[model samples]
Target: MSLESFGEQLRRAREAKQMSLGEVADATRISLKFLQAIEAGKFSILPQAYIRAFIREYARAVDLDPEKTIQQYDMANQEIRATAEEWVSRSRNAALRQTKERTREIASLPVFSQRSVTIFAVLVVAAVAVVYLLNVGSDSSQQDDVSEIAFDKVIRESEAATVRTESGRALPTFEARDDSLRLEITTIDSVWLAITIDNTRRGEYLFAPQRKRTWVGKEQFQISIGNAGAASFKLNGVELGMLGNRGVVARNVLITRSGVQKTQQ
Candidate 1:
């Protein structure tokens, strides 16, 4: 029931609901700084009278027990509402602490935003560089490329069935009434892999074809449809995974989320 323990419980509940601090703040219309202070057990950072009020709002936002949290805080800090002298002492201490913190922050402010921007830009550049390297290696004759490569071709057979959209056609893929996800691939010139799901990527299935197969993630999963090359794949009419060798038909891949796959008895 201590402040520290209450903070831990609050954090756990928030995380269990898959919420970020910013998400909570945005949903509750609360300030992020104050929310962080609450989570950090820096109750003195807020006005004393506002502490319980803030805690109540935060608990409601996160679906925690507000009254229980306040009771715990009171039990932990029994002298929380003592005489005027104690209140004065705590208030003065909190004010002095905030002043020192503000001074330190102002002194360090000049390069802070610049550093953050530089770091973010660097991360973006690094991501682009990695993708460029992958495409380059695929175009070249590199054997060690793990990044997926894609090649596109039209499917004359599927042209009659696919429902065309701006991005691509929506061809019927398998669906299980009991499961929330499904993946199915079919093709004539090459294999057409399809993965349609109600959830974001919870897993993947790897089918290493004999030739290099091109796999791509569009709405779900996609692969190249047509082409006589040793490697080709198709999903929803888009060409994605490509392989190199000439006379191969299929390959084994690691499928993620093992039990989700439907097996016919």
Candidate 2:
């Protein structure tokens, strides 16, 4: 059976059990995004081991035989692997043919004199050096921009910490809030995140390294991190640190005005 067919089977079983994706996520401790991906037959969303484990849990949640479901998944996955291998082999052969044709074309070209070749090489080196120096200058400018942004952020946060009310009374940042929660996320590496605000607004985000974002909620925030160590969290301007070790996925991390509640995956 195809992977999509297998996914449909799981979906049908879940429907028979009258289980929503969120219910399965709650029961299995899996991310709702992953559950959606599984039902769509997008096993490439996670590593094979995690996929297999999630599938097993999903199967059990819907009262399907875990081993049998896994066997079917394995058969589908094997078919996909075989297809990918065939495509790779074809690509390799095509690349080899192109390389050989290019080699023949190069052989048919007139050869340059040693002096001309040496002059051409020198010109190339000079061009490369100029490009390198330009890139270094650009990098230095970018670093300066980043440093300025960081400095501005520090100043803004410091000023925000003690804001004056309309009556000219200085109010503490936390005390001024009336049951509002703020979450600040900074990415150290490329990562995927699923965020829920006040249990009403939900969003999925993919962030590149050195990205910063903030979200506010009236009551709480729920977050799922695809690469836990790739992101640092701050709640109400207080650093919460990394979610877990590198390459680890963390799910059902709840945060409120009180504190962070972490669920180990």
Candidate 3:
């Protein structure tokens, strides 16, 4: 059977068992929308990790044989997987072969004299030392006048949830700051501002529309949320939190044992 057909069959079996989409979602902790997508045969909408997990959950929830359903799915998609694997293997082999050829070409180059190599090494070390000293001197000089370490990076804190930027557009990604944090805000309409610190909901206030709000911090935990704007942040690859329209804002913040000083605007 075709992969699409297999997905359809799975959906039929699930419905025949009188299972609601939300029930499966609740049991699996997968989103209701994602569960509906699976039932609709829109398997491509799911990430690979969730696809298999969804299938397992669906089967188990309907009392169908999970192994059989998975086997059928594998059979249906075997050709696609095999073709993809073949392409990946060929690409890897080609890259490795090219690397070996480049290595051979470099090895065949004329060798420098021993004295020339020694001078090059000395110059390289001097250049590195100069770079290190310049960076250190610049940092030290800035410390006296700098109020805070200020930098802007995208904040991506959730895998399944989307973050809205100040532009009223969804951000595909976000960045985290190690030295300090930045929170930028703007409103399409006069609305309330509610933010959370370290996943704890903070205060709320009325913010006028078309105005920009900005916050600067050296704190470990940071988040800002409002009804009229978008908010998101990241610490490395992990998402810190996501803010959406309506409801009290809940955000995650990382704190050291000594605790972190926080600010909101």
Off by over 4 Å in 1: 79-265
Best by TM-score: 2
How many residue pairs clash in all the candidates, one count each?
Answer: 29, 0, 10
Off by over 4 Å in 3: 79-265
> Which of 1 and 2 is the better model by lDDT?
2
Sorted on TM-score, best first, the list reads: 2, 3, 1
Error of 1 at 46 (Å): 1.5
Instruction: Give residue 217's error in model 1 in angstroms.
Output: 46
Candidates' C-alpha lDDT: 0.45, 0.70, 0.49
Task: Give the number of colliding residue pairs in candidate 2.
Answer: 0
TM-score of 1: 0.30
Look at candidate 2 and give me any clashing residue pairs.
Answer: none
Q: What 10-residue stretch in candidate 3 is worst by lDDT?
A: 148-157
Q: What is the lDDT of candidate 2?
A: 0.70
Predicted candidate 1 versus true structure: per-residue lDDT over 83-135, tens digit per residue: 33354455555655655555465556666576656655565565556555544
